[model samples]
Structure formats: structure tokens, C-alpha cells
Target: MGRLDKLPPYLFSAIDQAKAAALAKGVDVVDLGIGDPDRPTPASLVEVMAAAVADPAFHRYPAQRGTPRLRQAIAAWLKRRHHTVVDPNTQVLVLIGSKEGLGHLPTTCVEEGDNVLVPDLGYPVYGQATLLAGGEPRVFSLAAERGFLPDFAELEKLADEKTRMIFLNYPNNPTGAVADEEFWKRMIAFTTKHNIRLVNDAAYLEVVPGGEAALSLLQVASPSKDRVIELHSLSKMFNMTGWRIAFAVGHPELVGDLGRVKESMDSGVFNAVQETATYALGEAFEGLLAEVMDVYPKRRQVINAALAKMGVEVFPSPATFYVWAKVPTEESSIEFCGRALEEIGTVITPGLGFGTGGDGWFRISLTASDESIAEGARRLEGWK
Candidate 1:
């Protein structure tokens, strides 16, 4: 089968269709499905981009592996935020967005018949990328009983000589599960023993509204020494989702390999966007991030309280702008979420849209506006 034929349907498209149907019926819908932030990019960054766009230097084809200044800024941010150090020249590669980097990563290492380990309940890109790279994707369960972490024993059983890489997302999508330092240490040891490449999608790493910063894999394993890489984005950090600027940092060789794949596929991020990102990571970092993150904690509280009133069981975590909860009724996640939209005119994500392992769960995104969150919560409270 062709690579495209091997892939499953894109989940969010189905959700969008349902939402559109509800809207067409003149139902007032409060969409809490997709995780795109409803806020605008920080004004400071926008102003910088406006000026940068007029610079003749940035109007060219742009630097293939990011300009020196942006790579240096990314390295410095890693040191300041995660307390990790990497060589700006060799260990950093700018991406159009973390999603694009992730889509290209499997091509760098996987050959036909090789397999990559992917979470059963994860961002769909992981497995899809593997298929596109002509590699098999082996599923690893992230059970709620185990706090949505993979069991090492289960991993050992699934991996074999052909296993090439493992994809992980902490401060994870859909589940809001953050991996602590101890978990990173164990993962590094396991992957090292198996001689497998390790990749962590750290897009939501800085989205912690709970005050305790999330740990980066680089903090535990030396990317210079280990076969590891972490992809970080400015999308969530600065409300720059549409800007499409992120970077990958890790083993110099791995970073270089991904860069090679990107060279053939795309021309790299717009230089103006990269400059704006550099500014975002520089002096404006703290204040702008604070402004972006300040809203999530209260939004989370609103949804959590409403879910509590409805007697829904939530998988508690303060990491991402997502609330993962069990389906209160006997229905599957699809049925429960469908009923929620039809009966209450509120949209929540079905866990089955993520994977079969997510069948009994549902996800609520805190990315909606305050008024929308309030309305959605009100509707959910009356749902049943």
C-alpha cells in the first residue's frame, strides 16, 4: 500500500465536521476540542516581526539550518529555562514548527522494516511519520493506572533488533502527564541499553501553570553523548502557533541528520519569523510567557470544578492546557463526546480519536477564551 493509504483518517477533521453540523443547526456551540490557543501572539513579538519583515536580509531564501543568532538564542534559552547546555552550531536545528520537524525525524533514521515505538495515546504524528518513512510503528500503552507512562516491561517485550527509535511527549498531549527527572533517568538507561534513538516532543514543556517547571530530557541525558533529541516550540510558549518557528536540540549527528532531510523537503522557517522567535527567547521571554500562561490555571479550575460537579473522574495534572478525564457514563469516548455536543451544544475531544487505548477517556482543552470556557463548563455541568 502507498504511505498515504496506510494512514488512518485525520481525527480532528471528523471533529470539525461534527462541530460544523452543530453550527449549521443554529446550536450555540462552545468548542473545547482543538488545543490551539485562542489568544493572539504577544504584542512584543508581533511588533518585532513587523520590523523584521522589512529587512532586506530576511527577504531572501533564508538560512537552511537557522541563522547563527537564532540557534544561539535557542541554546541560551535551554540553559536558562531547562538548565541544559548544547552546542549552538552542531546540536541545534531550527524547524518551521515542531510538527514539521517531527514529521521529518523518522526519515533521518528509519529504514524499511525498522520499527519505532509510539505511545498508544499520543499526538498522531508520531506513528504517521513512521509509516511515511517506510517503518513499522509498534504501539506502547500509556495506562491511566500507571499515570499514562509506559511500563518498561511492556517496552522490553515490544522492542527488537529492528527497533530504531522511540517517540515520547512529556507534559504530554491529551493526558497532561509530565515526566519527572527519575522517569527521564530510567528512559535514558533503557534506550541506551537497547541502543535505540530517543526523541521527546517537548512542545508543551513550558506550559506549566503550576509553578514547578517541567523537566527536559536533555537535563538528564547529554545529547552530545547520547542518541537523543528534543523538539521545542515557540507556538505554545508565546501564543505563536501560526508563526511556525521551533527548534530541535540533541546529539550533533542526529541534529545534522534531520537537517539533511529538511534540506530536500523545505526551505526552512521565514527569516523574519526566526528573528521574532529569537526576540521572544531573549529579553521579552519572561513577561510574555507569564502573560500567555496566566490564563490557563483559572480556566483549568473552572473545567475541573464543573467536571467534579458532574462526578467525572479527572486524571489530575497541572502541566498542559488539557484536562484528561474518564467517561462518566457507560458509553465509549466517542459516544460520550457525541452526546455532549448533541445534548449540551458543548464540544469535548473523544479519546478514541487519539487511539484505541484512549477509548474510555475524554479530553477538554483549556485553550478556549474565558467566556467560552465558562459557557462550556456551564453546559457540561447541566449535561448528564
Candidate 2:
């Protein structure tokens, strides 16, 4: 089959149709499906962007590998936030968004018939990008019993000479799983031994509200020595989802390879956006990050309590703005989520939308507004 034909149907389209039909019937629809933050970008960052936008210096095409100042700021931010250091000149590459970097990554290494190991329960872009690059995506299970982490034994069995890369995400999407320093150490060894590239989509790395920071793969793996790269986004950290600015930091060759692919694929991110991002990652970072993250903990608590009252088991994690819950009934994830919309006029994402490995769970996004969260919680409690 052609690559397009091989792609699975877009999962959200069905959810959108169901939501639209319910709205047409005048039913109140509380959407908790997608993980887009409802919060506004920090005003300080917006002000920076407004000023940067008017600067004539940024009018032309931007630096393909990112401006030196932005790249340096990213390196400094990594050291300040995660205590991980990398060369801004060699290790950092700017992306239009983390998603854009992720989609282009497979092309940097994979050739036709090569395979990439991907989490069975992960952001769909990982596998889909592999397919588009003419590479086969091999699935590795992330079982609930294992705290949604990949089993090293399974990984050993799946990987072979043709395996080009492995993609991991933490704090994970839908599942809200976080990997620690020890996990990172083992992963680095595994990838090094196999001579395969390791990529972590650390989009939610800064979303922790538990007073302890989440670990980055680069913390344990040397970006200069190990074949590893990490993609971090300003989207979740600073509520800049619409701004589409993020950066990749890791092995110099890997960063450069992705940059080379982008040279032909598209222009770099707007210089104005990069400038704004530079400022966001500068002195104002901690304060703005605190403001962005303060809302998720309370929202998480509200949902946790509601789910508890309903006797639904939530995968416990204080990271990311999502609550992964087990399907209380025997119904599959799709049936459960569908019934939720039909009976309660609330939308929750089915785990099966992620992968078959996610078959019996559902995801509740905490990115909704406070009012919507409270209402959705009330409806969920009442439904039970």
C-alpha cells in the first residue's frame, strides 16, 4: 500500500464528528479530549514577540540551525533547569515546533526497509513519521503493569541490524508516565550497544507539579558521546502551543542531520518567534513556567477525586496535564469514550486511539478550563 493508504484513520476526526452531532442536538459538550492548554501564553512572552515582529532584521528567512542567541539560550536553559549541558553551536537546532522536528527526524537516519522501534502507546507522529520516511516502525509494548515503560527484554528481541532509531516520550502523553535517571542510563546503554539512535520527545518534561523535576534523557546520556537527541517544546512549558517554537538538543551529528533535512523540506522557524523563545528561556523562564504549571495540579486533583468517587483507577503520576484512567466497565476504550459523549455529553479520548496497546483505557486531558473541568467532573461522578 502507498504510505497515505497505510496510515490509520485520524482518530480525532471521529471524536469531532460525535462532538459536532451532540452540539447540534443542543447537548452541552464538555471537551476533555485533546491536550492543548487552554491557558494563554505569558503576557511577557507575547510582548517580546510583538516587539520582535516589528524588527526588520527578522524579516528575511531565519537561520536554519537557529540564531546563535536562541541556541545559546536553549543550552543555558537546559543547564539551569535540568543540569544538562550541551554545545549551543553544535548540539542545538531550532524547530518550527517539536512536532516538526519529530516528523523530520526519521528521514535523517532511516532508509527504505529500515525499522524504527516506537512505543506502542505514544504520540502517533513517531510511527507515522517513520512510515513516511519509507521505514518500518516496530512496536514495543508499554504495559500498565510496567508503569507504561518499555520492557528492555522486548526491546532486545525486536531490534536487529536494520533498527535505526527508538522514540520515547516522558512525561508520556495520555499515560503521564515519567522516566527517571536510572531508566535513562539503561536506555543509553541499550541504544549504544545496538548502535541505534535514541530520541526522547521531552515535550512535557517541565510539566511536573510534584515539587520534583522530571528527568531528561540527556541528563544521563551524553549528547556529545552518545547517539541521543531530545526534543523540548515551549508549547507546554510556556503555553506557546500556537507559537510553534521548540528546539532539539543532543548529539552534534544528529542535530546537524535533522538540520540538513530541514534545509530542503522547509525554512526555519520565524526569527521573531525564535527571539521570543530566546527571551522566554532567559531570565523570565522560572516565573513564567511557574505561572503556566500552577493550574495543572489543582485540575489534576479535581479529576482524581472525581474518578475516585466513581471507583475508576487512575494511573498515578504528578506529571503532565492528563489523567490516564482504566475503563471501569468491560467495554473497550472506544465504546466507553463514545458512551461518555452520548450519555454524559463529555468527551474523553479513547486509549485505542493511541494504539491497540492502549485498548482498555481512556485519557482525560487537564488542559480544559477550570469551569469545564468542574462540570466534566460533576457529570462523570453523576454518570457513575
Each model's Cα RMSD: 0.9, 0.9
List of clashing residue pairs for candidate 1? none
After superposing candidate 1, which stretches have Cα over 4 Å from the reference?
none
RMSD of 1: 0.9
**Which tens-of-lDDT digit does each residue in 1-384 have in candidate 2?**
898877878888999999999999999999999799998998998899899999999999888889999999999989988899899999999998999999999999999999999998989999999999999999999999999999999999999999999999988998999998888899989999999999999999998874467888888888899999999999988888998999999999999999999999888889999999999989988788888899999999999999999999999998899999999999999999999999999999999989999989999999999999999999999995
Cα lDDT of candidate 2 equals 0.93
